[model samples]
Every structure is written in structure tokens, then in C-alpha cells.
Target: MTSVSEGRIHGGAVPLITRGPLRTTLRAGDGVRIEAVYEPCTAGAAAADGAAGAGTAIVLAHGFTGSADRPAVRRAAEVFAQRAAVVTFSFRGHGGSGGRSTVGDREVLDLAAAVAWARSLGHRRIVTAGFSMGGSVVLRHGALYTAPGVREEGGGRTEAHGEAHADAVVSVSAPARWFYRGTAPMRRLHWMVTRPTGRLVGRYGFRTRIDRRPWDPVPLSPVEAAGRIAPAPLLIVHGDRDPYFPLDHPRTLAEAAGGAAELWLEPGMGHAENAADESLLTRISDWATAR
Candidate 1:
């Protein structure tokens, strides 16, 4: 990390400020290289453009098989950039990043890196918004990084440092529990990550690399994680027509939060980033700003 004036830091070789967009690679706590991009808030952005928040940086987490360069992720980033600075990154084994994807297991470290990078860029307030698999990550990341006295088995985790925590979290189309195969899309997704032949399809068809190893101790579920995210505001958004996880997923998460989270069920919406439209993004931006 490169230190700059006023106590700001730059991850890898990325400078404090750049002429246009800032694109660079960040090293996670576990030494995985994550590909990330930083886009400053645009001038003269209107509320319709989702420009209600300022001086806040949103660390955008993409869903499984999604990357910073993906069309859906890029569109979301573009809309959020109008309101606040936006940081988008690819988890390990996705896009140009290093290592294999542990699904959402080790991806929390990737999000931690991005959040820390957002702080280093001088954003005092950080909001994390994720979709689908990324939504599960934001929930777990918020719980691990923000809740006081929380400790994991790994000694080198980023939670103790406090720099990776998000001031606000938005989970869109996330699941409450783990290892759920109720829906066909989820079952196919499971096969894609767990089976050798399906992993090939993930690589060639989706351009995502999957790690064959299962979770050693199985991390906290999204519902359990949601319970810990108090003080920090949480917004749970789910589509009524989501094919992956049913409405029960978001309901469980909101219930687990014990009224600390706000749940929004979008009518006719499907799943993840591809399903998140402009109006919903506008409302999300407004919510983050209010926090």
C-alpha cells in the first residue's frame, strides 16, 4: 500500500486520483489478486441518475460468474457513479483476477479488499451493494467486518483491522441459508461448481473458474450474518419472480435482522443484477444516502 498526503493510501500501483477511471489490481488479505475499477462521481448528475449520495463510495459486488467488466455489473456501476464514487471488482477466478472461486466462501476477503481500497481513496462513508451470490457476500462481509468482538478461526482475517467494514449494506436477491437446491437453476448452479464436467462448462460457458474444494468449516449463513448487522443499516431486496432462491430467502434474512433491515420485494423482477432495473437502482442509491 502506498501512503499519500492526509493519510490516504493507494492499493497496488493505483494512484490517489487519476485523469479518468482508475483501474488496478488489489491484493486481498490472503494474497489473492483482485481486479478492480474506481469511477468518480460525475458532475451535474440528477436524482433520476441516482445522484442523491455524495462523498460516499459504494463497493459493488458482482454475482457468481459475473465480473467488473460484465454488462450487468458495468451498467449498475454506471448508474451508481452518478450518485457517488463506485468501486467494482472481480472475485478470484473471475475475469482477470487470480486464484479459483471458492463460491462465496473466501470471496469475503475480496470484498474486504475492495472496501479497504474505497476507504484508502478517501471516502469516509462506504456502502456495499451486491446481487445474488454477491448479495450473500455483502451480508457476511458486513457481519464479519462491522460487528464488534466477532472473530473467525483465521487469525489473518480483515475484520480486526476495521478498515474493510461497510457503513451500509444492500443485499439483492440473496439466499438466507446455504447448500439449498430447491430450484432447478440452483441445482444446475451446484452441479456447475461441484462437478468436474460442470466446472468445464463454467469455464468455457460462463468464463468463471470454480474451486473443487468444499468449505472447511462452513461460514455463517446469510440469515445468521444478517442478525449481526445492526448499527450498520441493511436493505434486503428480492424479486418476486426470482427463480434461484424463493421469497422465503429474503424474508428469513429480514426476520433474522430483527427489524434492523428493510425488505423490498420487487414485483415481476427476476434475479440478481440483470434483473435490477434503473428505478430500483435509484431507490437503492437514495436509501444508501439516507443512511
Candidate 2:
């Protein structure tokens, strides 16, 4: 359970001034206080059960070099919160969390903490949704805990962190595999992770705390993880116009997922949650809610 005494939401909302997000630091097992916010649905939905108009809740994971406060992340949270209670958190090393990001490797612990916090708050049906790096985390985290007690390969080093019983999973603009430097954006990303100058830029400019070391064993690939999210529905959303990984990445994940996953490729989109148009977000909101 998330400890309120240890980490509490900083401020309360004034009646007419602002409906601030309910902010708290969710404590990860390794002692990282993952900065998180539980945003109830719009006022209309707030009046309904579980503040979602339904029992389902959405947990959104931001992209690489992004935190919860990023405009793109907030926009997605705002849209999704219209249909379901949205839980948005900064992965360890991003925003207010403590730790250097191992990029996609140890981030699963961050997501697991948020998911467990949502469950503790009485959200029964949880939808694990992520963008880019966070998207890959969602896929691997799902595969890690098909059963609550039996820990699997992808849950990082620790034991079964939490029961990865997401009712639905959505991956937006995620990479199928790591160390992919095929595109200009990815090449730049590699530099940011592997070089000192890039690390400095990531730390100061982007506020993304990237680790110096590479994945030793290398965590499970998104395509490999996608295959394990069976029985629990998976939605793979990618952009045909993405600069990072092309449509082939999504196709690979979709192929691994077989019939359990639905692949949607947008025509004029760029990457991650930032490029997700309102119409597409609406469809996503509907899909998560309906299922």
C-alpha cells in the first residue's frame, strides 16, 4: 500500500480557483519516491462510481526523456481522464523521482508502483497505458506477472513486484527492440545515453536522468513481451510517419501478439503522445473504456 505519512499530496484544490491534480509520491520498493498524481475524471464522471463513470482506471506512462509535467503527457492525461480516472507518474529518474534511469530496464518497478497504488485506491479495473519507453515497460511488465506470485523474466531483478493484472494494455509508438539506431532520432538518443556530453544534455536540458551503463543481460524485448500479454487485450498504436522506429516495429509486436493485439497505424502522425490527435485519443479512450 502507498504510505500517506511518508508521501502525501502536496496541496488541496480551492473551490473556484483551480482543480489541481491530487499529487503524491508513491514509494517504490527500492526506496524511490515516484512522483505521481491521481486525476479523477471530469466533474461529470467524478459524480459517478470510482470517478470514472465506470470502475476502470487508466495508468499513463510518459515517453523517453519525459516527465509527468510534459505538455504532451498532460494532454494525454487530460483526454483520458474524461473517460476514466487517470493515474500519471514520473518514472524513477524523471521529474521528482529519485534514481538514474536505466532507460527501459529498471523502469518496470516505477510502473508497478503506480499500478499497485491505483489498486490500493480501490480502482478495480486498471488499464496500463504508456508512450514510447513507457509503452515498452507496459508490455514487459504485463509479461512479468501473468500470475500474482509466480515472478517471470521481465519484472527486472526483484521478485514479482506486483500482480500485473491489467485489464487492458496500450502501447503507443514503442520500439520492438533496444539499441536500435536506424533513424536520426534514435542515433541522437544513443549518443545521449552512451556519451558524457549527451548525458549532460539529458540531465540538464531534458531533465531525464539517464544511467551510464548499458543493460548487461538486456531486458526482454517489446516484441517478446507482447507475445505474453495474451488473454489480456493489447493495443499497439504507432505512427506511419514516426521518425524513430518505423511501422515495422509495431508490425513486429503485432505479429508476436497475434490475434490478441490490435495494431493501428496513423498516417500523418509523428511520435508518442505528443502527436496523438484528439480524434485518435477519443478512439483510444473509447477502446479502453468499452473493453
User: On residues 1-291, what C-alpha lDDT tens digit does candidate 1 reach at each position?
Assistant: 111101112355445533368888888767778999998876444632554565688899999999999999999998887677899999989999999998888888889889988887777789999999999999998877863354544543434247788899999999999999999999999999989999999999999998888887788788999998888899999999999999999999999999999999999999999999998997887788779
Task: Candidate 2: give the clashing pairs.
Answer: none
Candidates in order have lDDT scores of 0.85, 0.79
**13-127 in candidate 2: lDDT tens per residue?**
2222123467777666556678888887674535364443366778999998888888988999888888887889999789988888888877877787787766666666788
> RMSD to native for every prediction?
5.5, 5.8
- Cα distance off (Å), candidate 2, residue 24: 0.7
- TM-score of every candidate: 0.89, 0.87
**Clash totals for all candidate models:** 0, 0
